[model samples]
Target: MFKVMTGKQAAELINDGDSVSINGFGSVSHPDEIDKAIEERFLDTGKPRDLTMIFASGQGHNKKGAYADRLGQEGLVKKVIGGHFALMPQIREMIARNKIQAYNLPQGVICHLFRACASNKPGILTKVGIHTFIDPRFGAGRLNEISKETWVELMELNGEEYLYYKTPRVNVAIVRGTTADPSGNITAEKESLIVDALHICQAAKANNGKVIVQVERLSTNPANPRQVIVPGVLVDAVVLAPDQKQTISEIYNPAYSGEIRMPHEQINRVIDEIREIDRRAGVAKERSYASMIIGRRAAQELRPGNVINLGVGLPEMVSIAAQERGTINDLIFTIEPGVIGGVPSVGGSFGASFNPDIIYSQASQFDFYDGGGLDIAYMGAMEVDQKGNVNVSRLGDKVIGVGGFVNITQSAKKVVYCFPFMGGGLDVKFDNGSLTIVREGRIEKFSKEVQQISFSGNYATKNQQPVLYVTERCVFSLTIGGLALIEIAPGIDLHRDILGKLPFQPIVSDQLKTMDMNCFTSP
Candidate 1:
């Protein structure tokens, strides 16, 4: 049996020391009203203390309204297990200072672990985290010194090796949906994305835990069976939010819910708005000369009819370059939030796409990713060591957890990394068909050893998977001998601008080639 109640009443179920999992991706699909209500209760009574918070992907509107941050800020959480938390400044501060036990795991693995919990399995076993930071050989997903409890371990059944992610007892699940019937049947038809709502509910129920759902409306009539994402029998409580926005940052928008088709022409306006927002927020890219060059070179790798994923940062520029090259129609673009064949949005609406060809559930999208359906993936590089291992997940203490980077890069047939040779003020010039470096950044991107390995160069060599690291001045490819410098810009001196700048020497191919002149002279 289930009861319909107010958000405040529903939030009371979150007891002290509860292991809580909230179903959402970014700011979308969050149980905002209920989440705020929980924090309010904590502020008033401070009853729920020492909780374990878990999430597959990020959930927050921003710094001020982040639900997870409220938990950490109010001393409500004892430990945190999340897929991504870069957006949560307060929570990151807590983790950096070792205020709480924190762990960052793969988004796919955490989401799949819900399935494992639902099925009453011991844990999830996969090779996704092998050789990366999540591997037990590494810190075993620990993000801080206080993360002493090891929830991940190495396991082998038969001849194959696996990383078994031990399941945690999820005592409560916080989810959101559009409407619920008198019988508590829930429908997520109004959401921008249905991200593991079913699994989150089931995982809590499997543990005999409480289920709290936030919904926009309560239906006066019975809901159709087909409309129910989570049946009434599984849900414990329904929290009605009369004024719930579509997403925390966004109000009701038909384009997000696919209720109305967003005009192709209007998408640029939306993108511009998002870019302006990002600019004000200090996350906007200034379209550097190196980024433009790398984008142009990386776009050339995309072939007609290929399924490609363009990661954030420099790789996001690849789409613009593709459009400029008049090759936009030649390939498909995908983001991890299940928006396929549509132009992926950025910033607030990034998880949703404009005029999507198809929108599947997040689980289905990960199924595609895990099965190696992506042909090629373009990602950014914070650092790349001498061994070809790229570190985009973490740099120093900043925990930019592997949020779908692993599943996509590891599964893709070809992986392209767009980055720069140096880290500081890198000035470049294009004259005729040649490129010149006026100044260079002081930070060394190429190191003898990276702070962390997000992608294993050794794995690429073992699987014979092709990888290319494109920069403004040079291009390197994965070889049996390690990172092989295969191409260099025409005007740049190999020893001065390229080789001498690198902290470590790379294998120079005997038949080293010059980059195409079209890249420099292109309009």
Candidate 2:
């Protein structure tokens, strides 16, 4: 039987220097009360030094009110392992200062690793990290001196090479849901997807670790047995957290997908305004209007009744463009880790945003994505190859592991890639409310080959899914032959702007048109 306790009471299960695996994704689906309890315990006892905190993705409430933020401020964590932590500046500083050990692992690999542990497997084996920095041959997942030994090791199975990702024993597992029945069965229907809470609980149980759950409400009877995601047998404690709120949905008011149905006249007006802005700013070329132009183009693809997910970087800007065009309310916007109908966080804080309407655990969100419930996904790419493969994990010297790009992009019906024509160094000039490119970027994001395969081209082509590559200078679509050029920017000669930069020639479309002119100036 599972006992119901307050957040503080249940958090006492953690001991000093214990390894804790927190179930979270960015700002969505985090255990609030339990996190607060952990912070309180550290402040009161001060015994836990070198505590290991493992998370599959970014964890932390913002400065205003997030559980991870409180814990980081209290100095309760000594080491952290997981994917991205862009949302938690305090924790990032701690890792940068060598005060904590931080390991960046692929988000999908971490989720699957937990599943492997639950199944009593040795470790996870995959080719996702072969040529990237996650491999031992490169920098691995090492972030600081404390993580020198945490590099991923390569192994072979029947002469086939693979990467071995090990999982450590968990002392505690903290999770959240919408409600729990008296039998300790939890459900998160309002969340974007069902997470992997059961797997975490079972893994913790296997290691004799405690499992704590935080929920918004407790039901009088057991929920429909079929809907019970985490059985009572795997749960040790339950905490009622009615006061805890969803982070991202509250910050940005997300419009549900089923509600998006904009009038064609409205869209045209917005496009015209954007064109005027670009023309006034002398941004007649598509490459020069990359950011705003791509935003407008993506907005055109959004349908009224489709569930959509947006990745960080340029994709984040699409929401603003959508909002400006009065189409914000017609589309449902969801973020990975079970946040639905919320504004996405910008820049480094890619995890959770300020306010969200619905919040669920990280595991549940993955279930939704894996189940193929999303209609479309807009993402950013560091490099894309002719085969239509995308790589956002490893660049020349950096190792920012795939956060949730693999899950969301691979599962969505349509994947739109947004990026600049080039990266590295670029100069821009904004004058008289007009924008101009003083100099072009130097780095090449499109290559004959990529550093790693985050989005598999073969898998995409096999499924016959629609993949669109949008850049400042041109737009391309993945075709059976290879990359096919679909559009070109104004004021750019096709050979000079397109063929010269690419490693190989892309099949060109005879119907290629100039980029819209309204992206450069203010409406």
Candidate 3:
């Protein structure tokens, strides 16, 4: 029913003005060979112009001239509907310049939309984007002036309001897997993450569209039915790429695919290697004294036997601190890409877990997240306002977009935001449990109002969700009256260091106390 083809031949299957959905999370599971082939064909022949590119999670390495950037040519991509774009610089540049129509939706919502599309559902109705930027009352997820289409609308059912996200027609789906059988049965046993491949393939097939799969190798015999992720009936073409890497980071790691469990000592070495790589690439700040302090403070919120998710960036420090406290194994860790109960990898290998307990589809994992399965979710914040609303999506002219922030923060029983008090050029030092600010940064993250509302404080308060804002200098708890100062670092003057920096006054706790001395100093 399906034919085997070269990457270039498979690229030819994509017609001009087609809506293409790519199944991947970050750089993992990307059909790189086929995508590169498409780029080559477009540059040489100028065919397949004005395409609509869609993806749930942002793909590409966090650099220029890589991944999605290959297809970021002027006429190649006319529009982009994606979740996160910070890693895809060229595509982000096009969107920022208004050269393309762009809409930034929540990653989880996009993943679920694929599933809805497979069944020919009109749209998805959920409270995930309510009161956030994706809500119709706000910007409705438009990233630039050219994004004029109405894909999300506000609706009310049974006296409750929800944001209904319309499904888009997927004419082609670019998916990747480890191996393909003679019948085009795809198995992902060697891939790092399955992502939304199955749903994307089904969505395209349901619409009488093509499903192009990139696999590492082809098998002469039929594949076992139990191991086939996408049956042969759903596959239209199979492109063999024998040299495919597991992820953008490594060539192949058995631990990532759950083929083998990594030793605790070996896992530490891998983490160290990743941190060194991140440091060299400038993807993350060197584990500074301030970051350690913030991490230590945030890790205190973790309870034993709790299911938690530590978001990328500043929130990742929480895990390092938890590991230092010897409490990392006591709690379960989950990532947005559907990995559960294993140490989540960092840097370029983030979406893939090392020795995972279970790997579910991205949509299924979001179903758990949307249903309040997370006990606590620690995320990074760009700005915090008096209303207790946090903004991690957009800042000034940059459109970072909410990537699972709305879903996790809105549904988690407890939400903790880890951030620095100041931005740009902050300097700090600690001595004998006392913290001192050497130099303040030019940018103030705490303000009277934020530029965007990624997480609605009012919504969380309405649901009686407990919230905390953890910083290097102090901690604030979200009360009914807004942000309440609960803890202050020792040797930091309240008036000069804390109150003077804030644009508005906050209610000081009646029993305010000094932060634990251990948080400031290394064990």
Residue 359 local lDDT, model 1: 65
Stronger candidate by lDDT (1 vs 3) = 3
Which candidate number has the best lDDT? 3
Residue 520: error of model 1 in Å?
A: 2.9
- Point out where model 1 deviates above 4 Å: 61-65, 247-249, 281-283, 521-523
- Give the best candidate by TM-score: 3
TM-score of 1: 0.95
Worst 10-residue lDDT window for candidate 1 reads 61-70
- Pairs in clash, predicted candidate 3: none
* Per-model TM-score versus the true fold: 0.95, 0.68, 0.98
Task: Report every candidate's CA lDDT.
Answer: 0.82, 0.69, 0.89
Model 3 TM-score is 0.98
Q: List residue ranges in candidate 2 displaced over 4 A.
A: 61-65, 73-75, 157-160, 189-193, 248-290, 297-309, 316-377, 381-401, 406-416, 421-469, 475-487, 493-523
lDDT of 2 by residue, 1-523 (tens): 8899887778677777778887755555667678778777767877455677776776653343365656664357778777766556677667777777778777766777777777788776676565455667666777667776663689889997678888756667888777888778887643333445667787888788889988878889768876677887788898987765554433211222112333545544534554454445453233334577677766667888778888866786677678777777677777775567645444323444333555555556666776787898999999988888888865644445577777677678899998887776554544564334567789888899887777777667767979888876678988887788987665666877678888978888888876554444434
lDDT of 1 by residue, 1-523 (tens): 8898887788788888889998877777778777778888888988689999988887764565475556665478889988888767778778888989998888888888888887889897888888888888977889998889988999898997788899877879888899999888898778777788888789899999999988988888888887688888889999888787765445776777677788767977877887887778775667787788888988889899999998877788888788789888788888786678767777666677666677666767878988889999999899998889998877778877888888788889899999888877888889876788888787888998888878889987888889999998889999887899999999889998878877888999999999977666565
